[model samples]
Target: MNKMHDFEASLQVLRGSETDITSEVNVIKTAVASANKRTAIRFQELNQKKFRMPLILGIGLLVLQQLSGINAILFYAGSIFKTAGLTNSNLAACGVGAIALLATGVTTWLLDRAGRRILLIVTSSSL
Candidate 1:
């Protein structure tokens, strides 16, 4: 057998299994080769027509998020609360900070489960 088959056979022996793993090894090899080839061709693939829409949308969303004044609002939240006539403006600012922290924690948990697109849509719509 070839090197890959030899490796697979050795692994099977180490695992103390008599069942054949040739098909599994071939599948894994095929997937690895495809991944390597894709990496080599990635830049050329990026210039294709099919990739334009997603690229434009991704960049546009990032630019819009930066331009939305969210950072300024967060940074100056205490001043904003004071200006808005809150008697305990510091407390209000702290509340805002706490909420932001909680939201970040929730987002971290939900990101893998709900995915990027869903999270982006929910956040954008809420804002």
Candidate 2:
């Protein structure tokens, strides 16, 4: 028997089972090899025509999101709110955070039901 079969048999013995596990080990090895082959095929197919547009779209959306200035607004929310004449700047900032949290929760709830593209269009347009 091979080293792997010997190792499995030893493991079975340690686990208090005297039954041969060579066949089980061979089956597991076969399954692993098949999975590896499938993974290799998928990796090779990542850059194919069918995946190209969606890949580009996802990257473009990320780039646009970064360019949207939302990050800057969020980072300086307290100062911005103060500049806008809000007496309680920190409270205003907290309100902004709460609204953002609520929007995120609503978006997550709507994602599957509304679908990604429609939600993306609506949100991006609103922004």
Candidate 3:
């Protein structure tokens, strides 16, 4: 895990037009494989004791994140821009994605720092 993180840190340094993508991607693939091995071993160890709760939560999050409506929002992002009162939806969708990304970051950051009630209030007020 530590080595994988270090590899990723180095990979980031190779970004931009000057970087060789094929080699970089190969390195990333190797890092990913290492990470997968570590994850499999960790899970196998945890299976001996108690891994149910966190595993269930992870699977639930995965299912929720990939639900039809979430995919619909991604597929119909252009429509969302128009629905949000933008004239040029193609361009507006990019802005919408940026805003959504920022909102996700902020919400995740506030999840523990701010209570659920206050978080809902802030989100609702923004909407």
Candidate 4:
């Protein structure tokens, strides 16, 4: 109740004198109702046949992402580099770490612009 009052106070401050607490409360109620409707619709959609492919693809992608050996490689990178005849194994490991960070940043930037299908194809192919 105290948090709700604080939220109302902040909202009142933002709206200035244009609206009252009742209006703010009504607005919140409307938003909640809208979200509930959307949730119900999504739940219904999940039961339909059309959504099956997408649901399977999402699950498969998640499983593949986990099963990939990237974590193990990163964990044993130093020894791997040493075994591969690198004189400075630490420097090689650091290079791998830098590449991983840069790849993550690049992937984030590309995801929104290139879209998921294209990005996934590119990343999977590169592997």
Candidate 5:
């Protein structure tokens, strides 16, 4: 209740409120319970036989993505550039960062336009 009062105080700074904060908190609690129930239903549905393949594929792909050396390159970008005889490794690292940002922008654009299946296929194939 003290935390809820603190939260209400924070919001009151931005907006005036005459209503009881406890009532608002009760409404939020009910909404959260409904959301949790829906999520549990979805999890039960996902456990069905029809969803098994997709669940496996999704988990497998996530594991594979971690196994990929993308993180290694990003983590040791300076050392990588140095090993490749680049005098200004920092510039190379910055170039890598810029390219990663551009790729993320392009992927975000393509995901809405081209859809997930195509993007996943293209990205996984490139990997």
Candidate 6:
């Protein structure tokens, strides 16, 4: 009985004498609409900014990374094969690199819809 009275008092404070249930519902809906509008405006502003420049920068970086021989061992793997007792380590390394690249692309495709936070967590832990 005491708890029931406390609950009724809290409900009265939530409703007040002037505010009704419909007004409370409208307030919640307005808050959601405001949030959505703010998000849409943010997206519009981003679209109005330098979006194509990011693509050009990305392509330029990829070209530089590929042509610059950043990973010399990967680019000239024949020397590694000669140093070791292996005969075709270069071709084997190339095949392994191709398989790893394919697997990474597939994982990236899956991560698009599976949420980035989970992938970030898993990938960081893997590192």
Q: What is the lDDT of residue 88 in candidate 3?
A: 95
Among residues 3 or more apart in sequence or in different chains, the pairs in candidate 3 whose N, CA or C atoms overlap within 3 Å are none
Whose lDDT is greatest here? 2
Which residues of candidate 1, in runs, are more than 4 Å off?
Answer: 1-58, 125-127
Model 2 scores a C-alpha lDDT of 0.84
lDDT of candidate 5 over 9-114, digit per residue (tens): 7666645666456676678768866876744447668889999999999898988878897788899999999999999999999999999999899989988999
- Cα-based RMSD of candidate 4: 5.6
Per-residue C-alpha lDDT of model 3 across residues 25-56, encoded as one tens digit per residue = 67768877787774344645656546777777
Show where candidate 3 strays beyond 4 Å: 1-46, 79-86, 115-127
| lDDT, candidate 4, 31-108, per-residue tens | 877876743456657868988889988998888877897778989999999999999999999999999899889989
The TM-scores of all predictions, comma-separated, are: 0.49, 0.71, 0.46, 0.54, 0.61, 0.36
Give candidate 5's whole-model lDDT. 0.83
Error of 6 at 6 (Å): 80
Per-candidate clash tally: 0, 0, 0, 0, 0, 0
Best candidate, TM-score: 2
Deviating ranges (above 4 Å) for candidate 4: 1-21, 24-51, 125-127
lDDT of 3 at 63: 71
CA lDDT of each candidate? Answer: 0.83, 0.84, 0.72, 0.83, 0.83, 0.67
Candidate 4 vs candidate 5: which has greater TM-score? 5
Q: Give one digit per residue, the lDDT tens place, for model 1 in 1-127.
A: 2487678878789656977777777787888788767335477687899998888888988888788988899888889999999999889989998998998999899998999999888877876
State the RMSD for candidate 1: 6.5
**lDDT string, candidate 2, 87-107, tens digits:** 999999999999999999988
User: For residue 23, what is the lDDT in candidate 4?
Assistant: 71
All candidates: CA RMSD in angstroms?
6.5, 3.8, 13.7, 5.6, 6.7, 14.7
Cα lDDT over the full model 1 = 0.83
> 58-108, model 6: which lDDT tens digit per residue?
677577667667488676566677687677877877876898799889898
Error (Å) of candidate 4 at residue 70 is 1.8
Candidate 1 TM-score, true structure as reference? 0.49
